[model samples]
Target: MKRLIRRMTHLRHSDDQISARVRAVLVESLYASPRSLIIGALTSSAIAAVVAAASGDEWLIGCAVLIGLVGAVRIVDALRMRGSATVRQQERGYRIGALTYAGLLGVFGLLTLTRTDSGVLDLLSVTTAIGYAAGIAGRNAGRPLIALSQLCFASLPLVFGLLLPLDPLKALLAAVILLFVLAMSDITQQTYAVILRATTASEEMAALAEHHAGMARRDDLTGMANRTAFREHFEERLRNLTASGEHLALLWLDLDRFKEVNDFFGHLAGNALLVAVARRLEQVLGDRGIVARLGGDEFAILCGVADARAAGCIGSAMLEAVRQPVGFNGHDLRTTASIGIAIAPDNGRDADTLLKNADLALYRAKEKGRGRFFFYEPLMDEKIERRRQIALAMDGALERNEFELVYQPIFDLAKGRITSCETLLRWNSPQFGSISPAEFIPIAEDNTLIVMIGDWVLRQACRTAAHWPADVTIAVNLSPVQLRAPDLTHAVLAALSASGLPPERLTLEVTESVLLDDVDRSLAALSALNRIHVCTTLDDFGTGYSSLSYLTQFPFQTLKIDRSFVIDLEHNPASVAIVQTIVDLAAKLGMRTVAEGVETPAQLDQLRRTRCDAVQGFLLARPMSAPEVIGLFAEQAAFRSNPGQPALPGAD
Candidate 1:
């Protein structure tokens, strides 16, 4: 039984198992073809040599030559099978080889059936048929169709010859031969079933394995490689870099303000956006690098170039590609990415280290500002760890009420009194002594805690200011995250109602950066606020990309000149000219202008002469506690209403 199984089976299989034909060729190359060729060549050549010695028959000699030619062809086909022949070539070779064997066996059988008359010839023909049957049963069972072909062509004519003699003994012999042919045919049919079953099983197993492999390596949503694939590929590239003495750059990119897309448009749109982004990365990077999705809104690239400048150029190109508008269901959605890069051997020698360093650089790019790229530096890791610690501390700071707002008065220059106080959020955690807004706010934004914190800030600021004099308004800066919230207008209205602050007494300040993404949504949100008489101010004027355009689109009652322009106001003509131009523009547009960060007397004098509507800085009044602001207002209420007291020098 074991011997039969051994003869029936082929090679188990190789790892690259693709199709059944490939498996058959591999098996025949290793087993069936060579064995059958050896037996057939020895039997035919020896019979031809013997017949030539006994009768010197030219016909038999010619048949011998034909057999030799067939043998040679089979050998060539076998060689092709063993080598690098393509699947099509291998299948074609197998078919031709099988046909050649069938034709040669048919010719030998015909010689016995029609032209042969000698006793030795009769014996030779019978012996050849019997041997052929035995050989095919053993050697060709694995490929049953070819085995049956050879069996029929070799045995059927011998049976025909025996029956034509018209004798009872010969008739009986023919009956026996026919029975043998029936038995061999049955074996071939059964063998075909077994071979087909085995091949189909193998194909099914291979398909299942391939499906699992795809699942493990590919992201189901984006169809790009997943984290496991990224790590393996990145590490392999590192090894190649070591051997080739070349450099590889690893880029970690994150979509800027991507959550807002999900928040506003729903997860389906966000998912479609991710798929589009993956395709865009493939289109932009092409063969220059490998792109993989690290996880939501984050992707990593492995580029062959080690040079920072070349990588930077590639990064810039990718940025340009992503910045194009993606049209979805007639809505044009735009997005940008922040990229961080780390070079191989310079950043790290392994995948984990390289990914880590690249992530560190990514945050730096975000910190400097989003929609840019930064290279990895040692100091970045320290900053990253610091941010991580701050993020950990901020988890419950709101519930604990560790957050407070300090009011910095915005002075009314023409009125000679304080008009509004800008509410600035402050966090003095028990774990970390007073964390800077610059540091903790970004952490909150990254962790998706900004909206909750912003809502809390708005409610608290309004509640605190509602107790102040009705004329003193409260101004609050809204995060882009908060602006993207669907219920932002409702949140503002709820805050005012909860605080009993009049709608007109609350102002919301926003940057042009907030409006850059989903302009329609931001515009709608600003309009909603304005409809309720909530004043809108464009904060950090001249600092964002499109100031003039923003002023035209949004109903901004006030424009605050950025601190950058104010710092060098007296010393730099460019600064003075910018402030003058902004003031002039604001006046013509009927909007108030506030110059922030005023420190020296000359800066204040220049701002007032330029007809700036208001000023807010340390020179006038520092950010103070609510109680301190209440006391200052109480002390100034009588003096302000008197209308006879001169304003403090720069406070105006």
Candidate 2:
């Protein structure tokens, strides 16, 4: 009994799961339209008229009247269904009414069969009953149960009445009618299955389309609105705010030093950190605004505010939220964000304009020092336009011969002669003459123009130094962008092979920033250079964190103390101690040291006492053109030959 109850419950649950629309459609198929009902009623009246006229049977006439009444009632019910709450509500009533109509037709047919002896009456009544039963299958197949019930109600009585004659022909006819009823039941079941399958597949397709649309608007990793969706929302909000004259703030957020995290940890850890940060931003903003991940480590926020002060407060909260360290893979990944706020109406109201200005402000924040926010100002646009013009001019600056290399000699403090010259890039554009390296080199790096420019510098420096005295090596600065290039090692080899300069005569100078990005890759590149007998010098030594760790990681031939330490060596005891300590450490590590920016004789003398290997500064020589460098080498050779005169003009 329990098993039976469970099976019945399961069936009921399955039935209840069908959508309401499908159920209504099935019920609607059971009730004919008003026109169809009226036509069916008139047909019944006609059949009754024919039978009663032929047989002169008053009982047949009465049965026909009853059938007509039921038909009229069914027609009235069908008409009412047009404005009904739902077709499903009238399902049971319609089924009963249909069965009644079928039973009355069966009664009329039976009375005709009993009262008439003519073969015509018998044939007409029997044919009408079977025809009505067959017609029910086509009209009511959406509801198989009701269809089958009507079929049996109309046909079974005639089958029983025909069997009462006890004749073989009549029994065969009855058997044929029973067979017709069974075939109709199967037809109804098949038709119902087809309708149900079609309806269900359509519903599933609609739901799947809606799901895909939602996915298109969402970020895959962070599950926030993507760039495209954010833009649309931004435009829509702007439109809504236009008439109200209220201000909306668009905050452009960028994670600072995120690329370093990706380089140190793997990309998976970076992605996990991004997801955590997105959650924090969402939680911090809550219902006050909408946050979107606008690709990479950048995000955007939209909120209504009265002015820049309110926007600044929101930006402050966002910065604090992002400052929280996220734990991943047993390490606390700490990051900070820079925010740029552009207010609507005051900042030109359109999405593209506001976003561009906000991005400009964000760049300014990072430029000044990150972990802060800035509002868009009109002056920023002019500065950005200037930067854009500079970038555009740089695209073909090398091909136009606008770049030149100058050499600054590094003198041996004890030997009192130049040992190496660091090549410095200079841009003398005809459009904007004498652009500083500090301003333009960063612009080049930002646009990836540094890679091509750095390569040229390497080859040119090698070629220039090939003609110099063999004892004097050449140094070329490598940017962090160049180190990440896959062809860095190849570029170095090609430069050496083309210039006919020995690998030992070339020294590649790298700042500590290089090691901070992808330590393994940087070490591999440096190791490849070392294998080829090329020297690597760690420039700006004391400015970076983990300076000692970097020295142990790679085989650097020299450490150049930063100019900040060398400039104050005479007056500041701490600077003197730093220089001495670096000199001692470099000597112990078997690496040479050079003091940069040594101007005063006192600073140079102090460096000499500390046993610094070399010094490069304006005191000895400024960066000079290639021709001047060649002349200086010639002067040194002249001094070597005489053995009496000074090797340099200002030598001690």
Candidate 3:
């Protein structure tokens, strides 16, 4: 757990240095105290000018005039610094002005002592007068170095001038001025520390705020900007386009088979694939535009383009980049992306419209065929709206009992009798009547409705098939979604117990590819089912990831030859060879084989010749209603038969 937290921390932005940022803020704010500094300087110059005139010393009057000149120059520089934007330039100007102010204070202290008849009275007065200007430096304590420097330079000169005179009062006044300078120096340092600490705290807060804002804008899983950031950034890009009317394209991409990845692999594996895809997008596009993960498996890109053809070229490149294979858990997994492009001004003038059009184009690309790209068209929105409505309606279809199960019988070709029946799901919606399983099934799987629907089908099939002959086994397909369910074994057992059916007469068929999702978990679930004597088979056998390894690792009872191979039996020798190979493999492994989509007696004869154990297709029987299932069995007196055993009376 600590390691996972550590990895997550590594992905976040590194924190900024509070002290350095605080320093920059202070330097930029060098003009913060100019008004007070000017007021103190003007007041000091006036008082020193009065003393200079009373003493009748020309040098004292000259010192006050010089101080006034320096004060005026510093105030001017401070104003210029306030107008400047650069921190470094502002800081340089502030330091020069402060030094000049310090120099003027030093000159005033020296001028008071430069008199020839400077007695104990004059010296004591000079020390007391220098103390007033020293207070001005204390007022500028936020600039500690300048404040402390001015105090020390101004007070030390007058104190030393007093020390030169051998008088108790002069020495006492000199010590008092020295004490004043020391106190002011401490106050300046302490005041600066308080200001600096405050600045540090403010900068820390700013940094923390920025970090949180960045987190909100970025996807945690993929390290790409999320939808909010994408919208904001794309709008900014639109605003920045030059008057030459440069074309910009917004490409929306969605992984074609991302759901299959999550189903076949686990979510962790799916997350890893998304991260890899994010990197690939970064590498392919590189600074040409912005690539962001809008949400799960969907991404959006904004890039500069000259025309529609340029956008198409970039979209094609993105498609190929996503098409590359990813390796996870010792398997090379392949996926493709369907991309949609929306050009600025051509598709839509602004961000929201362009994004909607891009998304529409993406759905059209997926609808046409996966692993392709499409440009936005106005009509695509209408088609996608219809699909969106269907998907929404499916959410309540099962609850409303719009779904039903039909059983297609599997016949023993050699013995000429029904061995088992495979359950097929069908949905008849009031809004869209008789939606094909191919259409609605994927939609359900994509939206996670399949798991509930699959569970319902399992229970229904078991309950309906319980009254069938004891020798007959009923097969129902298991979706990968159900296989991932934690309560799958319990659900199956409950269904069997409720239906009063023996586990021996119940079969759960899974696709070979779906079994790859957390293989241990699937195996453990299947193993638990096996303990109750339920039969397991790998259905649509040769269609995906056909590995002999799974056949051995899993206790699959049958390998159903896919319809594709069966249909090509008379025309394609390779299909025939493949079927023969699977049949021979199944036999040697102590498993049965069932050929699917057998529509002709010739195909059945060919399957029988190949020694395939059973056949299922329209030729034997179409999927029938539950009552029709009973009627056919009663009319035909269908009995389970084993080819290896001697044929009993009325077996065919």
TM-score of each: 0.75, 0.64, 0.71
Better of 2 and 3 by lDDT: 2
Which segments of model 3 are wrong by more than 4 Å?
1-18, 28-30, 44-65, 82-89, 112-132, 135-137, 160-171, 241-243, 259-268, 327-334, 407-422, 430-434, 469-624, 632-652
Please state every model's RMSD to the true fold in angstroms: 7.1, 7.9, 9.6
In candidate 3, what are the lDDT values of residues 87-157, reduced to their tens digit? 55665667666666666666666666667464543544464456554664556555555555566656677
**Candidate 2 residue pairs in backbone clash:** none
Model 3 RMSD to the real structure? 9.6
Q: Across residues 1-652, which tens digit of lDDT does each residue of candidate 1 receive?
A: 2432333343223213446554554345334467566667667656755654455556656776776677677766655554576554654566566556555654665565456567786577567656766577556665554565567666766777677768799789878877786677667657655765676687688778989998899998988899899888877777677556567998899999898888887888888888888899899889987899989999988888847888898889888888887888887777899999998888888888988898889988888878999999998888787887888999999999999889999988887678899999999999989988988887898888999999998999999998898898999999888887988988998999999999999999998777876678889989989999999999998877888998899889999999899999888999889999999999899999998998877888888888898999988889999999998787677776776765743444
List the global CA lDDT of all models. Answer: 0.79, 0.84, 0.78
- Give per-residue CA lDDT, model 2, range 1-652, as digits (tens): 2433353355346557888767776676655456766777778767877887778788987887788788888888887774555565588788878899988878777777667788888887778777777877778777666677788788888887788879899899889888887777767667767877886787678768888988888999999999988988999998888656568999999998676577667799899999999999899888877899999999999988877888898999989999998999898888899998899989977999999999889877877767899999999988776777788889999999999999999988767788999999999988888899988898887667898999999999999999988899999999987876767888999999999999999999999977875687789889988999999999999898889999899889999999999889878999999999999999999999988897877888888899999999988889999899989888777877887886554556
Q: Which is the better candidate, 1 or 3, if ranked by TM-score?
A: 1
Model number with the top TM-score? 1
